[model samples]
Each structure stands twice: as C-alpha cells, then as structure tokens.
Target: MELTCFKAYDIRGELGTELNTDIAYRIGRAFATFLKPKKVVVGWDVRETSPELKDAFAQGVLDFGADVIDLGLCGTEEVYFGTKFLNADGGCMVTASHNPINYNGMKMVRDEAKPISRDTGLADIRKMAETETYSEKAATPGTLTQLDNRAAYVEHLMGYIEFETLKPMKIVVNAGNGAAGPSLDAIEAALKEKGAPIEFIKINHEPDGTFPNGIPNPLLHEQQPVTGKAVKEYGADLGVAWDGDFDRCFLWDEDANFIEGYYIVGLLAEAFLVKQPGAKIVYDPRLTWNTQEIVEANGGEAIQSVSGHAFIKEKMRAEDAVYGGEMSAHHYFKDFAYADSGMIPWLLVVDLLSRKQTTLKTLVEQRMAMYPSPGEINSKVADADEAMARVYDAYKGDAIAEDRVDGLSLEFADWRFNLRKSNTEPVIRLNVETRGDKDLMDEKTQDLLALIRQ
Candidate 1:
C-alpha cells in the first residue's frame, strides 16, 4: 500500500507518479463511506490536473450513492463556502497550493467546512485508499450538477466586512497566476457597486495553469520579492499575493517590505477584537509573544494551540474564537464556518487600514518594532531529531521554561526560541523572537543555528 500521499492535513503528491485518477477515485469512495454524506461539494484550482481529479473523485462519490455539486475552477475557500452555504455533507478542493506545476493534491472538509486532518480522519482515508477494497456492489450512483457559486461566495464574504466608510486607496495585487484573479475581480466589482473608493492595481491577474510568471508561493523568499517589487514600483498603498489555490495570502508594505504573518496575526486579532471586544482569538504556540500582548491589550482572550490548521480550527470552534491565526500565514475566522480563508484576512486588513486613514506600514510599524523576529529559518540536516535534541540539551540549563508541545520551545527572560522538525521534510524549522531587540534576536538565532549545524 502506497501511503506517501497521506500528508499531514490532506492527500497530495505528483499527479501521475503518486496521485492519479485511480487514487483520487478510491479516496473519494473512502471519504463517502467514512463520512456517509448524502451529497458532496467539490471545487478545484486552475491547475491542469484539477478538473481531472475532481471528476475522478466525484465519480467515486457517486459510485457510493452520494451526489456531488461541482464548483468548477474556484479557490479553496469557495469550496468551503459552497460546503457550508450550500449545505453539503462534505467538500473537497483539488489544489497543489503553491507547489510546483507537476504537483497536485486534495483538501477535504467534513460537513460545514470542518477540516479532515490526520488526527481526525485523514489517516483512515489513507488506509482505505491504500487497501483498494472499494464497495463491490454498484448502487444507484448519484448525479453531478454544475453550480457557479462565485457570485454567492463573494457576496457572502463581503457581507462580513463593511466598506461603506472606507476611503480611496490604491492597492497592489499580485495574483502570481493563481486563482485569486477572478475572485479579486468579483471583490472589485462589489466594492465598485457600493461606490467604495478601493482601487486595485492588478498584476499577474490572469489565471493560467502553466504559471508563465512563476509558482504562486509567497511563502518562499524568492517568490515574495515579486509582490514587494510591485508594491514599490506601483507606489500602491500595499500589496497582497496569494498561493496557487488562494488559501493563504502574503502582504507587502508601502516600502515593498514583506510583512511577517506574525505581525498580521496581531493586526487582524486587534481588528476583530475591536469590533467584538472580549472575543476569543486563537493562535499557535510557535510564535505568540506579540499576539498574546495584542490580544490581551485589546480586552480579548488569547488561546494558544498546537501548530497546524486542524488544531487551530478545532480550538476556534471549541472556544468560539472570533479569529485564529498561524505564523505560517493561515488565518481562520468564525464567520467562515471556523475555517481558514486566504481572502478574508487581507480584505479585513485593507478595510481596517482604509477606515483608519493610515498605511499598512504605519499601522504595523510599532508592532513590528516591538517584536522583532528572526524570521523562520529552515536548515536541512542529516538528523533533525539529533539536532533538536542538541538544542534542547544546550538550552536546558539557561532556559526559564521549556515546552515540547509542537516542537522544542525554550523561554528565557528577554527571548524565546522554537526548534521543531518538519513533518513533511528532513529539515527542522527554527523561529526566534526577542523583546524588540534586533541584536539579541540575531545573536540567539545565530547561536541556535550554530548548534544545529554542529
């Protein structure tokens, strides 16, 4: 049984080498059998393989006597929106999410956008897919219906944000040949219809599966410079870039400087808390000092959970968290069925900045200065576990408190560091933060890397 397709959150791999139509079909059958859904909502990105996988998965679902509502060529969030708004029993999105062109994957959600992760049912789905023991009896397969939920998705999402008082601002958007182009058009039209002064200077706004420009992965340092350059070249108020599937967005300031998701988490947390004071904000423990301070200062509660979408969304649901953010750029909102949105966070930030009459840089400058991070540093080591153990041993004496929750976290008086091995790769991720001290941040980051490298 090939289990390599079973990722931490969803099923993903190369199209023909690892993930094929047969695998998708089997996984679809397993999903319907496990969840026992009457109807499923399916969506896909602009990747060439997306439609093929969608059809194969839908066939698997139909084979199990379950219907499928296909939202063709939509963002992952649209799938979530369709699942909840259309009242489907389950949802699946076919996207590689900023990976290379040869890669493709699927993201599943139980009823109403509830994520299906390894801890949830991803492992079971993998097991079932591996066994290849699909149902023998052919029941009355359900039919597939095409639905254009783009307008409805945009409308419902815009309703969450109020642009009535927003001032005219030139925003730069770098779609990077992903699915964000059409969605941005819808948003612009809606704002225009409402007579809002929001204007977007769009670049790479066309959706091309070939990705003529480059891969739409803003998380990569190399891919981020394009948006930053656009922000500076156009002199726009700010810049926003999305991944391949448009599920995660990266922001650039007026100076074309990339704004860390850490700061954006605090910024968005403050925005949401200002509206609903005393609301709960969920965050991952990997990076939190600023987020904690911001949330507490705004009269909101901060709940720290383990890193990853599954954990964050689950805690958000349990605590009724108004917002949840991870340092890795994933932002979740309660309004969106406690699911993460690559669109809403940027929209809210734009709305917040326009209404405040301040630039995105000006708004986040203080917080950025207050909490200087070492930026996430990743190193490919022969033994990630040994490197982590070495760091733990080296810091065990000087650390004030140590927690091995998601990774190895050591807290000191003025600084803290987290060193964790990646679940998907052979490298460990290290994130260090100092109390507004760059030199200290540099020193600690270097010291930790030295230890890891040794």
Candidate 2:
C-alpha cells in the first residue's frame, strides 16, 4: 500500500486509481494514531470529491477518539488559522491546489500550525497508513462539530493594515472559480462595513469544481493575461488572482502588466521595514540581488533560506523574522503562525500604496529596472539531475561563487543564475538575473536554455 499521493510538501493524486475514500480514511487514522491528537480541525476546497473525502477523514479521526471541527468549505490558510485559533492538536485541508480537475489532495499541520513535511511527520504517517496497525477504537468515539472561523480570519487579516488610511480605489479580483470566492467575499464585506471606498470588480466569483475558466493558477504565463485585461478594462488601481486553495497570489499593475513575484518580494521587504526598522526578513536564494539591496537599504537584515513553505516557515520561527517570501508567490508572516496567506499580501500592498501615495507601477518599476529578471522558466528534461550537472559543468569555469543551499546557484560579476530540479515534477527550473542589464539577462537566459535543453 505505497501511497503515491504523498508528495514532498503535501498529498496529491489522480482520482480512483491513486486516491479514494479508503486511502483518505487510512491517512486520517494514521494521522491520529501518530500524533494521538485529542482534537483536530478539518476543511475542504471546491473539488466535488472533497466533501466526501473530508467526511471519511473526519470519521477516521473520530473513531480514533479525536474530536473533529469541520470547516465546511474554505481555503488552506483557514485551516492553519483554525488550528492555532482553536488550540487544536492538528489540522488538515482537503485540496489539490492548482492541480488538474481530475486530481485532489490534502495538507496537514500540527499544533501551532507547524507544517508536516516528509522530514517531519508525513513519512511516518505514510508508513503507519500502509501497515494498517492501530490501537483499538475508543469506547465512546470522539464528537463532531461544525465551526465557521471566517469572521475571525478576516479580522486577523484586517489587523495587518490600517483601514482608516485606505483611499478611494477600484481593484479587479479574479477567483478563477476556486475556493477563494467565499473568503474574498468575507473580506469585502468587512471592508464595506468599515466604510472603505475600495471597489471590487469580481470575475468567475463562484466556486465550481469543474474549473469553468481553466485552473486558477495565475503563475502560468497564459493564465495571467485575463487578469491583466480586466485591470485595463476596469481602470483598476491593482489586480489580483489566486489559485484553487488561495495560498499563493499573483498581481498586475495599473498598465495591465504582470509584476513578477521577485519584485513584489522587494517591495514587501521595504514596506515592512518602514513600520519596523531593523526587522529580519527571510528570502529564497533563487532571486537575491533585488531583495538583498532593498533589505540592506531599509536598515534591515536579510537572511537566505532554501525554497519551500516548510523550510521558510521553520527558518522564520528560528530567527523570529518579520516576514518571508518566495519567488513562487508564497508570502509568510510572523504573526500568522508562520503560515503563508494569499489575502494578507494584497492587503499589505494596498496599505503601502495608500501610505506612499504612489501607484503599484511607480513602487516596483525602479526596482525592476535595477535588477532585471525574466522570472522562472521551466523545461521538461529526460533526467533533471543530468541536465543540472551539464549546466553547472559548462559555467563552473567562470563562476566566482557557487552555492548548493537548495540547488545549484552560480554567480558571476555581472549576472547570476540558479538552476534546480523540480521537487514535484520531472523538470529543470531556471532563474537568471543581471545587474541593470536587460540584454545580458536575455542573452544569458537563452544561452542557459540552449545548454539545458541540449
């Protein structure tokens, strides 16, 4: 009973063959058996199979004598929030999060919302699930209860910004028919109650598991234009789009330009520094120049961490950092139990706009020019390890500095690039950046691609 659904960070699998109610129940029982949690929080997304899966998982927990608090339909962050807010022993979210419509999965976290990765607890859970050995059922099974923590979650988001300072603005929000619709509605309702003059023009606002408008992943180049076009048509001050689970968010500017997450990391570093100078900010090593410069100039310390939510969260807690961001649109905050949130990033950006009295383009354009990057490019390879080795061998001669913190990162005087194998797929990911030289960035990007693909 090897579980193909278990991945590095979470659980994901194709329906029927790899994952069904039985496997889900086994995982639930295993999770309870390993942690021996007294109480657990559970939630699901918009996928049609998610409700049944959640029910099955909850029953397994109940049979193991662990109480279940079911949050009907919500994003992944809500479970992270509920775990800490309710003081539950653990939490689980049933969602595939940007995977195809035929897929579904789950994410689990322990007390205080600590992530459960393969290194931490997932491997043990998988082994226990496979063995099918558990303690006898409790004499009286644990109770089941329903809870709606949206209002409290929305209030927690509001605490990140000062609503009184918010100015009149129009924004475009595209939920892409995922679980984000309901959560965004709660935020909008809170904003309206506060008499904020922000206007939200919604698109694909319903939660449809069919994904009528394609997957909600705005990270794809093709998936970006829809949000950008809406920004221009609505004359919006900013544009935002979210994936199925709404853990990562993508942004668009006033000119309908898709702003890369690298620049947003720099912008956010500066924003947080303004409020709390000398704060520690954790960033990924893939893109360093922009975030490094901004953090240093703002009287703050910049620390580098390997890319991934679990690694970043662990580092933030270790250093007690103020904020952490990755180039993949995942942003973590110290106050949110070191969990990433899609809603909080945009709200903080809006606050920055109001406080700085500037547009989104004005804030990030200079930084983009200062450190030009083409964003991350992925190429499918027959062997990801061999491709990375080939790229490194070709460039190691002229490289002044080399790092393997997460993957291969080689730096030269004028430009640098990081090439790493994808943890979830058979692809090589490349990120190249130059010092204020777009042509060099372009030329090097092509050269690297040629070698990587050859």
| Highest-lDDT candidate | 2
Q: How far is candidate 2 from the true structure (C-alpha RMSD, Å)?
A: 0.9
* Candidate 2 lDDT by residue in tens digits, 1-454: 8889999989999999888999999999999998899999999999999999999889889999999999889999999999999999999999999998899999999999999999999998988888888656788899999999999999999898787788888989999999999999999999999887889999889999999889899988788999999999989999999999999988999999999999999888898999999999999999999999999999999999999999999999999999999999999999999999999899999999998888999999988998899999999999998999899889999999999998999999999999988888899999999999999999999999999999
TM-score of each: 0.98, 0.99
Model 2: clashing residue pairs?
A: none
Q: Give the Cα lDDT of each candidate.
A: 0.89, 0.93
Q: lDDT of model 2 at residue 69?
A: 99
